[model samples]
Target: MSVQLVANVLIGIALVVFLGYRQATWRYLDPTRIWRTPLIMAIVGVVVLAQTTTTITTTDVVFLGIEALITVGVGLTMGSITRFRTVATPDSKGRTIQSRTGLLGAALWIVLIAVRVGLDVVGGHLGAHLLTSTGTILLVLALNRAARAVVIDQRIPRDDREARGMMVR
Candidate 1:
């Protein structure tokens, strides 16, 4: 292993740790319908990336597909475990309070990153580029976000107008 790669990775890990913890500090963020498309796009884009990559093999894609499913399952479980509080009162901005009881999101973020890093490291040793590829990382993140969004959406209540429509504000 190159010393430079080790140093760079160490720095990256440190940054991720900091950011993961920081995410927990958020009291709450409004769940607007605006985020739906982007989150869905994130999930689709990774699959497209996988199909377009000529260097990756069929076996790699299958493995990644399995990993994606597993990640989604775990993410869903964790997201459900995460506590959300919808305050009865809307803010001055007229936004509902979508809050978490603990650092579950932060915890999920760390696990996602750690899993990606672990796979990358092992794949490097085995010459499995797919396992360590950018598409894999994006897929993990996309699935994680999707699961959380699904759970949070179920937790927050929307008005009749919003519910009647496809969007939730």
Candidate 2:
């Protein structure tokens, strides 16, 4: 394997471990916390893509498009399945929404990873080199996380008293 490929694999493993743990735990659904990760990943992905020299091909584009769609779809499904509850906290004006992925959401993450790997294998044979690149992987992951965050954010209770209290109890 090339150095880049090895590095990508190591990074992928690290992400799987870290995100897997984080997803299983309950976390405050603050906008900054929810959005920061994907945004940073996207910027880094763009930078990496810019620095790397690779020939662009229609096959690569098509594969990436399919991967992105699946990523977003899985993310949406995960978000919908996530457990959200409002809890009384010292911060956030008395209560705030907290989210936990639990087992089902984690399963979806595995499914997403499996689907990506399967695509990578198929795309590799078809000359879609970009699909498995470090930069492309990061971009796809960011897209997935962003989509999940969108659904979670939408599910959060509004500022209104009734809505905010809906999840409490």
Candidate 3:
């Protein structure tokens, strides 16, 4: 791979780790913000779909369909890991707040990135494209974020939802 490609991959890995940290430490944000992630994911999916429409074939269609299902399952699984790993403790004010260093969130990012890179390497040598499409990536992200948002939101008590940054049991 080119130096630039390597650099990009490293940067992407860093970005994922950072985002996972944010997710792990996420406290109760605005309820309206709940839609932001899904909306962004949808927009990204649309843009990716639009760019690839011309190249899509029947085989690609089937592959994309299968990929979407797999992404959802994997996304939820990872989200659950993040949820289970996230540490919630009460602040001095007696409201729950997630810990800053989310080891589980970092693990989630590492696992996903490793799987993607591993599959890409194997598939590339086999002359097949796996997880190589924008649709595939965007869908995975959207599903993960949406599912996490739902899972986390549901866990927060209704009163805490309105509170600034407290995580309620």
Tens-digit lDDT string for candidate 3 (1-169): 6564475466566668667767567553443455476668678767865675444455545545654565566556544554322236655655553422256666666676666666556554555442465545666667766765655555443445343322334
> Which parts of model 2 are misplaced by more than 4 Å?
89-95, 159-169
Q: What would the per-residue lDDT of candidate 1 be over residues 61-149, giving only the tens digit for each residue?
A: 66577667777876677557655445667667665555552576577666766776776666656666666544455556567656666
Global lDDT of each candidate:
0.58, 0.81, 0.55
Number of the top-ranking candidate, with TM-score as the measure: 2
Q: What is the Å distance of residue 37 in model 1 from its true position?
A: 8.2
lDDT tens digits by residue: candidate 2, 1-169 = 8999899889988998788887899876665556778989999999998887888899999999999999999888877888877776635544466778887777787888888889999999999888778989899999988888777767776652433211223
Select the stronger candidate by TM-score from 1 and 2: 2
Model 1, runs deviating above 4 Å:
1-23, 33-54, 86-89, 157-169
Span of 10 residues, lowest total lDDT, candidate 2: 160-169
How many clashes (backbone atoms < 3 Å, residues ≥3 apart in a chain or on different chains) does model 3 have? Answer: 0
Question: TM-score for each prediction?
Answer: 0.65, 0.87, 0.61
Best by lDDT: 2
